[model samples]
Target chain A: MQVFELIIGKLLPYATLVILIVGLLYRLNRWQRAAVGNIALYPSAATRWRLFGKVLSEVTLFSSFRQENQALWKRTWPFHVSLFLILLGHTRLITDWPLRVGLGLSEGTVNAISAWGGGICGVVALMTCLLLLARRFGIQRVREISTGEDYGVLILLLFILLTGNAMRFFTHYDIAEIQQYFRTLFSTAPTQVPHDPLVLLHFLMVQLLLIYFPFGKFLHVPGVFYSKTLLAKDY
Target chain B: MEGHVQVNETELQTVIDQVKAIKNGPRVLQLYMDICAHCGVCAEQCHVARTMPESRTNPAARSDHIRQLYKRYGSTWGQVLKAIGAARDITEDEVAVWQRDFYECSGCRRCAKFCPFGIDNSILTRKGRAVVHALGKSPFMMSETQRISDETGNDEGQTYAAFVEACRFLCEEVKDDWDIDVEIPIDRKGADILFIPASADLVSFPETHMGVAVFFKALEIHDGTTWTMASTAFDGANFGLFTGDDPHMARKNQAAYDACIDLGVKKLVIGECGHAYRIAKRMGPTASHFGNPFETTNIFLLADEYLQKGVLKFDKRKVDEIITYHDPCNFARSTNVFEEPRRLLSAMTDNFVEMTPNRTENWCCGGGGGLAVMDGAEKVEMIDGTFLDYRMKVGKMKVDQIMATGANYCAAPCANCKRQLMQLMEHYETGVKIGGVFDILGNAIVLEETKVKAGAKVAS
Candidate 1:
């Protein structure tokens, strides 16, 4: 188990990073290389600046999603927003220079802020994820369209959130030690991983997610930009 | 599944090969096939899904026919992804479903507006239709129109002599009905504008054709710029778009482009047919990047320019009925021509009311994607229930929208839209008069100079 933890902590991260980067680059290259037809939906932005603004609003605010399905948007918008915050909050596990020290906050304040703010975002993301999963199961139309991967993605996020929240609320770890572990891991050296099972589980799940990211619907992050530009650009 | 076409093993192999080709085809399509989250937001937005209430009618559900094939043949790793419920092999039954369901979508693209990913299922629908068309499994009406368009350069099968006779007849009709002496010029060399409307407008909605003739006459009188209809390529409606036949679409587009160069027209002004305008402006060889000799403009943009310039005189008092515009899918969504028609309608009628969701968000008129031209079981070879029945059923949303507006007339400018809405109104007994925007324009256009022109023609 210690060896397993060591590999998860020290070795697999490099593989995960390499695979994630190369896989994403390969995916982007494929999309870029494919022939594009003139199929843009009209009444789109006429100028590049407006087109950028339109695509930006769509990505940042889910503007088009809000226009029609406000109910789904209510849950999906918060779920995405909270997920983004949680991802940003994960800098705590790495170096806190940007999220904490950049803000000139003390370690005590950062920890307290992390416990409250991160706790809130984690809870929001968890609740929205549950609601979205329920929607998949409950709504017949949604169920009809959904595949196993759809269910698997939501459930994967559920496990990730549950493990993450368990660590945030149930246990306390030394920030310096976790950051040092990431530092040593990044430097190609062996280091002590956090002994918490939830930490290990969360780390393993996140790595698995990153490995799978470029291969699946998680590419929606990059894809939304390409599709919005493709579909909505007028001139 | 009843009465569906069956493919032999060789044909099935051919289909699989084609699906593999599509799986490798366009970036937009490849990304769309890969990244759809199956969120079902598109189902709610689809008029066919709402009215039909079937899983197959759902946008994503219909698109899944292609996605399943794409997964199996798209990549080497696709097999591994199948374990996660992402990939599947193409099957005969799925191909049969493709024939029925892909045609059912009007390709209105309303679903794209609500899709969080902006995934246009219409593109997928076209791909599916292309596969079916390759197998020669397109519905009887779709394939017939394509053949007719290919043979006669127009879907209506109107011969060139018949086209010339129709133009002469329309000139007399304009004189008798509106008391205006307007010349419907044919193949006039060095004309500034070349007008190509749906050929159906010549037979089915001649008033729209008449309205354009008058509008052109007014343009000539206003700026000495003239327009002519080519005897060789007067029809703008191309079923190639409907059947996803790229070669046929390009061939039909070449006919129109050749006419422009032959007549030496500076601009090609497409009449009120929606898909035709979209093709001429964007999809065809006339697309801007091709750098064709002539510019393309629509009737609404031209007429709206005149209205904005205060050059054309419209007697709003002539149009007494309450009128609302039905935004044709290709016009409103595909080509962004919603506002120009509405602006003209507002000037032409005092009682112009709007349907609840007008413009780009408007409901499809149930007859888009060449469904307007297709009547189910019209020919012996047609399988499944009649498309006429299907159109009426899916058009319920549009009928409801028109009824809610309480308008006496619904001015839908596209030839396909006019035919569909007229049939739909008749089917639903909605008591709504359906016609083109130019039909209303023809009704209200006051020809102050036309009376003198009529006298001069009489004197001559």
Candidate 2:
């Protein structure tokens, strides 16, 4: 148990972080090295700024997806938006941003907001993940095109969300201990990790997701920028 | 099976190697192959998938063939992921399926519009076709037309003398039919504009050719904007684009550029062909050759400019039937030519109506990517269906869209669209008159000297 904790709770975090960054850089470099000609769709953005704005809107809003399929958009837009907001909320794990703590709220007030807001986001993400999984299985056309990797990724996300929600609603975590652990890990110091099994499992799963990202469909997150820019930029 | 090519292990290995090398090729294609989420948004938007409803016809499934081969052979991670069924080795049967499924796609790019990653399946489709073409397994008609173009400088195999004679004969026919003396200037040096159209327009749809000649004559009388057709590079339709032969496309476009330079024209005008214009304007060397010495513009843009300037007048009542425009995939989506054709149509007829989904989102006429020029398998050992029957089957959606508009006339400006649509109308017995947007221009344009004749026709 001690060895498992040392590996998952200590060593793997740094190892996976390096792997994540290097893998992403390798993939991005591959994409950049390939030759891309002027294969723009017609009536593309007229200027560089407009093209930037267009790609930005597409990344944030999934505007093209909304225009084509409203039904799928209703589920996916919220899935992405909530996931983004949840990621922002998770900044509390490392250090509180001035925007949150600068409000001068009492610790009790801050804790209440974090509990409620974090819980709601967890629930939304969990529900959307299940719904997306159902969609992959339920829709015949989607099912036809889907491979094992598609289902495997969704199942992994489901477990991560499940562990996260369990930690949020059922299990207890020490915020100060978790913060100290992350601070020491970031600073390259000897670390003491929070010993809660659920917290460790969730962290390990997130690390796995990050490690697997560049090798799988999760590349869609960054690949969208290149794909959209190539298709939508005028020049 | 009837038209499938026989290949051995060596040929199959060659195709797999070519696909593997594609990873080192175009970034758009590489990125798309890497990033597709298999979300099936494209299947919902694809006309062929909607009509056919087969796994092979689905855009994602079709692109997956190449993606699978790519994953198996291209990357280290992909090879590791092979245990999870993410990738696999290529098979002889899979190559046969690749030949069919890749050719089955029209390369319209509608699927690209709605994809979450904006993955253009058409690019993958073209890549797949390119590899198959490397194997000498392209459809018979597609390969044959390219051969003819290579030999005769036109897909129709019309020689230089025959081209000049055809132009002269068409002028005489216009004089006899419409009582207009419009000359089709050929190989004329120092002209300000060089007009190149699909060679099919000169013979199959002669009226579209006549309309351009009259419109150019009007331009000449209006402001001395002289335009001439080049005997050396008269045909603008390129089968290389359809068959995914880059060398062939570049060679064909070089002829057009040489013609422009030899004539010393200020502008190169492409008439009524969408893919040709797309290749000339952006895709091929004409877009960047010698710093783009001559400007490339479409005929409708020039015509609409003149009409807006009041240099050309139209007798709107001359075109009596209700009209709807078919936006060729290459024009509407590939070249941004959606509005000019509609504007010209509005000027020519008060009864113009739009199909349900017009412009960039419009469905293909079921004959994009050079499928219209190919009727079926014309030679043995070719890997394709009886494509005329295939076109008719997939073209049912377009026939329905036109019928829903209840328009008697459809102005499809591209040569491929016209051929496929005309056959669709006849095959479905829809009684719709399929012609070019300029075909209406010929019927309705009131030339300065021909106003009396135009008024008489309107009166009658």
- Provide the lowest-lDDT 10-residue window in model 1 chain B: B376-385
Query: How does model 2 score by TM-score?
Result: 0.96
> How many clashing residue pairs are found in candidate 2?
0
The residue ranges of model 2 lying beyond 4 angstroms of the native Cα positions read A101-106, A186-188, B1-7, B288-290, B378-385, B450-460
Per-residue lDDT tens digits for candidate 1, residues A1-235, read 8897877877899899999999999888989999988887878888999999999999999998686788899999999999998988787666655746667889889878778889999999999999999999999899988888899989999999999898878887666777778777766465788787778889999999999898888988999999999987975
| DockQ metric for all predictions | 0.79, 0.80
Residue pairs in candidate 1 whose N, alpha carbon or C atoms collide under 3 angstroms? B376-B386, B376-B387
lDDT of 1 by residue, B162-230 (tens): 999999999899889887777888889999999999999999999999989888877777777788999
Q: Which candidate ranks first by TM-score, i.e. highest?
A: 1
Q: How many clashes show up per model? A: 2, 0
